[model samples]
Target: MTPKRLHLILLAFATTSWVRADLATNLVAYWDFEGTADNHSSASGGAAYHGTLVGNAAVTGGTALAGTGSLVLDGDGDYLDVATIVDVNQAWTASAWYRPDLAPAGTARMMVFETSGNNSFAISFGLRESGNPASTNHQTVVDTTPTNDLFGNRDIADTLTAETWNHVALAFTPATATVAGSVVTYINGLVSQTLVIPAGSTLIIPDSGFHVGTYRNADGRWFDGSIDEVAIWNRTLSRNDVTELYERGAASLGLTADLAAAGKAFVSVESSDPALGETFGTGLYDLNESVLIEAVPKDGSLFTGWSAPFGAEPDFFNLTVTASVTLTAGFAQDTADPDADGLTNYQEIVLYFTDPDLADTDSDQISDGDEVLESLTNPLVSQLNAVNWIAANLGGGTEPGDIVLTRDSGTNTLSFKLKIDSSETLQSWGPLLPAATSSSGVAAGLIAVSFPPPWVDKGFFRVVGEAP
Candidate 1:
């Protein structure tokens, strides 16, 4: 008779859920000061700078929203002329991470996209003081002449504290004949305020260019602060989209990966402290922490090359997590059998840790040949879902050893028993691994047997099979 065969081929997947968060498809420019002084960033085509850099304004590292850098404007007329001819009249969003170094002693125009000819129809933020740098707290500033009582409508309630990184996203849409929110401002993923742009005002696209760390005209007050992750969108973003931007950062866009094997690997993430990092998935590490992402391969196979700066070991690897990362791990089968136990190398690595050199790894007085080849135990099989059989083989760990149990393929519902802790004999088995049921699967087929992201560390598993 022929022996039964099972194959293991686990892979990582990014569903459509990953694409809906990023709203960068309509972004006109994104400036993340990673390297170079001016005109160095190409996130939005090229030459992200067209104006001049005044005083000692320079590019600095550390404390950035996306990359590991930011631009410091020294309040001394130091600013970057991002776009040489600002052409935004309606439906636009201006977003950036701002850390104010000085409070405005007087009314300061921190950043703006206003028409050179008409100043009322614009989007900006600044300290509402009326003199030199004053209180360290500022407010969200704006002015839609056609709407705000013929003057700029600055938010008196939403005050900004100096010397703190605040994610600011200001969006504007010309008021229509129908009732709708025209101007909206988001600070740290929360809506700060909304101003109604008058429908009667003329929506004018500025002729000069939008300014960063300063207003458009030369007379505009020089903003003294560190700026990072400045992004300009042609379309105003929804509140949900703005929240996603603040939460995911550049990851708002689908995480880019340099994976090798498409469907032969997976990356699981566990964030005991989300304040430091919370990213998940294979080839996708956007969090900040030390991590151990097991590169589980198919049965009788192993990872080819885990080529990423994080770590490069096979099934087990370590990484000092930083910002976003691009990773890929290769996979291939290992048919070499030095043990001559008829068990391949791939089976020993993934199915369970067994000495590739010794046919009797546990030295239980039984060779692997008698235990598996004859007893039909511990065969490497693909992850079968809860639907196929009541029970099946488990690719588990070593020690007290796991018993196999299974029913016919026609049965859809099944139950099993678990020995409390590590009970070698069935006489004392009781309780469960951790809870009443060690785990439960609610999905159809093999998809229901996956462990949660937090369970990727290391543990034991039991094998399942049909009764003789």
Candidate 2:
């Protein structure tokens, strides 16, 4: 009997299998109950096969995983028969939302379709018992072909709460010369179980008629629940693809970008002017919208760069949400002295201790680069370029042999040095002081070394590091 249909919305692209118009390239059949029991999916040349609502099953509201309504199965004999959608079956993926009415029993109560003859594929959900290792209940079952040979019926163990909604996905990948084919099942986008096909065993996807809410060629085994968003894809879907559906509902699934980041930096993004903090993530964004993606660097590091999203230049931070993209950011450290100067970049920039770019920042007619690279002397002091300053310049001041630094001179380990460019704006300070001399706490002080040496440029001095 043809049951009267009610309000339903056609959701051709929002099948929970893929996102957007590009995803429709491989859709074989989509059973979105859009106001009727017809296939709401498109086909080659405007010819689409609609299903026959047999028995007392009718379309109703508030039971949809997506769109407006869903087909309710009465557990009596209600089922929808659909003709063969794809010929020459290969790798295929199917996703659906089923709401079971009660606890499933030993009876392989079919929730969907499977032909009972040769060249037929079976899809069902049951409380399987016979050969389960863990003795787990509720299985998502798939049989590649009804020929029933050495290979068939790959049962993916699962559990379903009665009267609640569940998202189920079945995927099969064809074997290649290098890799073996396998059947993977997902409950809510997480791989519930995986069954690997043995080597040399060629798996075949049957091309035959299938039905929803009943067993094929059998009078009974009617699905006692509702089914919605029954979609089929010609190709296999990855784990991320399933997760995209699970995280975002069918209404927000299609044509979204799976955004990600890696190494030293994170991302800050937003759309419609909402403020999103700078951080890395594995998130999805809708398509055909403008998205802000900015790279943020860490402490003591600079944002090395950005990759052009949506074919823009590296300088462009705004990205138009179009495709699934991974934006990677790079960061650099303060230790990287780009100019090959004597002082480290941190000492020059952070501490203002010396010039990072210029070897002769003070420009006292002697470059620190020339002192270190040419004369091989220490650039920290005015001129005494000894690696160990405590022994060499203990009393070598400019007064023809005045004590530059004396042991126990000023109640501390004392070290003095001339500063070049004392104009504050163009000034560069002396380098890091050498290790103190006496371990017994030297109170060294310089006794007013005969009036500082007359200099052409203003020279400043600093006393640093008290002896402990």
Candidate 3:
């Protein structure tokens, strides 16, 4: 059958169960600093600069602007803004990978900012004491600087690699207590430190225009080295949350590059390569975090295009298999071939399907022909309770006339054998059969039979026919 036509439901008879899955988004933005060759200007007069691809990791063989580019390679201010787009008063986050040729002194190298007065805020990385340009001492600085207590600072003089790329991220929560609603910084994938403002700190700036590359104040420390994969989020990110961002950039970071585009919550920035890169802007707001973007496989489903090791579970639920039967099917006659391949019709119905002639239906293991003759319920069809019930009743009787049932773990099937004794009459046998057993001729003595080894496990078999 076509992959679309097969479906099956395998009931796992287990006391405990679990399924595995993952939840998160991998956002991509201008990676490798590749930008558009032509400068795109916003209505506010800010020019969008294109980054030129550099290094050996070009998207194309001969240095296509797809990966590895020099920032400001065109000499025009590779600056972009989100002042008109982002809601400044709400919580947000901004991050990037920057390698500056010159230490930003006396000025804020704005990664993301807005111009509105009451709702505006900015995130920058630079020297803590901006006045000393010649001094090598620098700190990972945030906020608008001393003008507001919102500044979260970390000393980075020892961490700065002059010409190498460094991953940086900042998460902001506006207007709340300093510690509760503030910014967090991550260097590489780890949180370097956290800054908190006291409850009544004066660093609140409600609205303002946001700028990237060079701060709007124009103190003149233009971002000289390459800036790649800049992103902005409308919500604050926790320390654990920032770790996710670091992971998304791990691929690029290993190559000394960033993802080719900005992903969700991404707005604007300057990079060395635009074509080899990508960045997100306004579209990120549409994603739903609660829903799973990927699909999972269900039990008894046919798995087409499945490749070896064969034992692993299917990755998705796109294919179908035979319809599942329930414990209610116990009353029906054995519809499957018995002893053809050493399987009973009841076993085949439990394991594969009602059609006994078909051997290895799904072709995974345990022959369909064999499953039929055993009278064992299909492991996929029988519920956990049913399996437990069979296990509990396997060998409880004392007299030779008592019935015994067992399960085969290797084949996952159930088996049964009846016992009759000279003392027991035929009338006693009537009560044991799955169906009503009536007296015939003279009452013969009962015989005793013992269940097999594999079927002894409490996990394997269940009663099908009534006592006879």
lDDT on C-alpha atoms for all candidate structures: 0.53, 0.52, 0.40
- Per-residue alpha-carbon lDDT of candidate 2 for residues 99-207, written as tens digits (9 for 90 to 100): 7766432134455555333434545544343122134354555554323443434455465555666777777776555676676878876888776645444533444
- What global local distance difference test value does model 2 have? 0.52
Please report, as a residue range, the 10-residue window in candidate 3 with the lowest summed lDDT. 321-330
Q: Which scores better on lDDT, 1 or 2?
A: 1
lDDT of 1 at 36: 68
TM-score of 1: 0.46
List the candidate 2 regions with Cα displacement exceeding 4 Å. Answer: 1-21, 37-39, 42-46, 87-89, 103-108, 115-138, 142-155, 204-207, 250-280, 283-468
With candidate 3 superimposed using the best TM-score fit, by how many Å does residue 134's alpha carbon deviate from the native? 11
Candidate 3, residue 230: Cα displacement in angstroms equals 0.2
**Residue-pair clashes per candidate:** 21, 13, 94
Residue 18's lDDT within candidate 1 is 19
For candidate 3, give the lDDT of residue 379.
26
Pick the lDDT winner. 1
Highest TM-score model number: 2
TM per candidate = 0.46, 0.48, 0.37
lDDT of 1 at 24: 59
